[model samples]
Target: MKSALMGSLKFQIPQLNFHKTLKKPRPSFLRGRPRPPLWRAKRLSTEAIQAIQSLKLARSSAPRLEEVFNNKLSRLLKADLLDTLAVLQNQNELDLALKVFEFVRKEGWYKPDILLYHAMIQLMGRNKMVEMAEEFFGKLENEGLKPDTRAFTEMIGAYLQVGIIDKAMETYERMKASGCDPDKLTFRILIRNLEDAGKEELVDCIKKECGKEAGGRFFLKISSAQNGKVAVADLQYHVLKCQKARNFAVSSCEADLISTLLKLQSRRAHASR
Candidate 1:
């Protein structure tokens, strides 16, 4: 009787169809959200193109280039002239770019612009034309325009590119003396390049300088994990890790004199209280 009752009671097990249960994702366009178009550089106007060609052709002869500029390119709108110069710089046409730059400088509407000088210095630096970069920097100074951090950094970078560590350090000192404070980029550029060149002493000096500049607020620490080479680690909220310093080891006190200064400052604060 028990067996018969158990056989009479049948439990139904429903099968789950996951394929029908899960909804497929719709394409962005179908969902009324399309991806934004990628940005492309603006094409140069016909007149600008012609002017660049003319300048390039006349580059062989200085007098011919001057004549071409005065006759054909001089009448260009300020916007057009600046744009043409930018294009020349992007193309790495240093000589032509300088020629155009001189013309732009002589324009009645022109003013001393540090950013323009910075761009030219960057271009020269990339080509390892250190002297030309210095010349442009000097011209900027002569124009009574105070060089900003970016301008100074580019000049420093130019020096570094030519493997002239001494000049780079001198430029950094000059930048400080001129009352232009070095930003994080300045420190990073100095530290990374100095480290790569095995100028560990200079790196230590920069670390202390940074601490002094920050007034004991922010500081950088150096670690040595890979082959016992020094690596910089920012102790603040954002850690600026050097690419070469992938593996982090214990922080070294000798590398972090900034922390020692901070400790003294803290002790003094307590003592004054």
Candidate 2:
């Protein structure tokens, strides 16, 4: 009986061999999905590589570098890799900068210091890399560095550039929670962004926070929109703003009603739709 069982199993093993050539092409679904390309480990050529190496070395003694080290000079950031990455970014060699950043980040030596993160903020903000810039700012505290006023300002500015109002406000709130005081400039930026976002109510709130005398423009805009109530152009900005605010994945009745009311009141519904 054992010999019969062994013989039966031996016959099955040949057909079950994973290395065997297939008689027909397998269906796509059965073949499993293709893997995503890794952001790290992306190689650069010798010429593009030399361009990065040619960038000026950031001395450990620059003004921005000095300001950060002043906080806790004893705590050097894991030996200067991120520092070099910052210099590449400061020089506006972004493609080379990204390549170096990606490499160092993969090696786990590129921690986010204020200057390093600042360079990224300015670079991405200028280049309109909104999502990536926000991601960099949001991950700050987790990287063991406190974001200073400069970092906060640059981060908030990046969020505003993307017109992500909620994220900008969220970053401001995080700044305050980190025991950093928000100056008048911060409030002014928040108000300006709110106005631009068509959150008239939020703009007014921030205006009151900024002492209200400067809130006249917000009220004027709101009043004009109300007067031209039925014109398609009148509610255009507000309609887009509402579209920006919506969280569309929900199936809740309240979400549906609120969305319907907004559409009904909006003369620019077709545009948003």
Model 2 whole-model lDDT (C-alpha atoms): 0.54
* TM-score, per-candidate, Cα-based: 0.59, 0.40
For candidate 1, what is the lDDT? 0.73
Model 1 residue 251 CA deviation in Å? 6.9
User: How does model 1 score by TM-score?
Assistant: 0.59
Put down candidate 1 lDDT per residue, 1-273, tens digits, no spaces.
987776655322223343356778853221124323211366677778788889888999989998889887898888778878988887779989988898889999999898799889988887889999999899999999889988998899888887899999999998999989987668767877888799988887887665444432445564547777777665542113321111121122223345544444455468679
Alpha-carbon deviation at 108 in model 1, angstroms: 1.6
Candidate 2 lDDT over 34-99, as tens digits, reads 223222334434433333344323333466333433333223343344444554665556665765
Best by lDDT: 1
Query: TM-score of predicted model 2?
Result: 0.40
Provide the lDDT at 153 for model 2.
Answer: 67
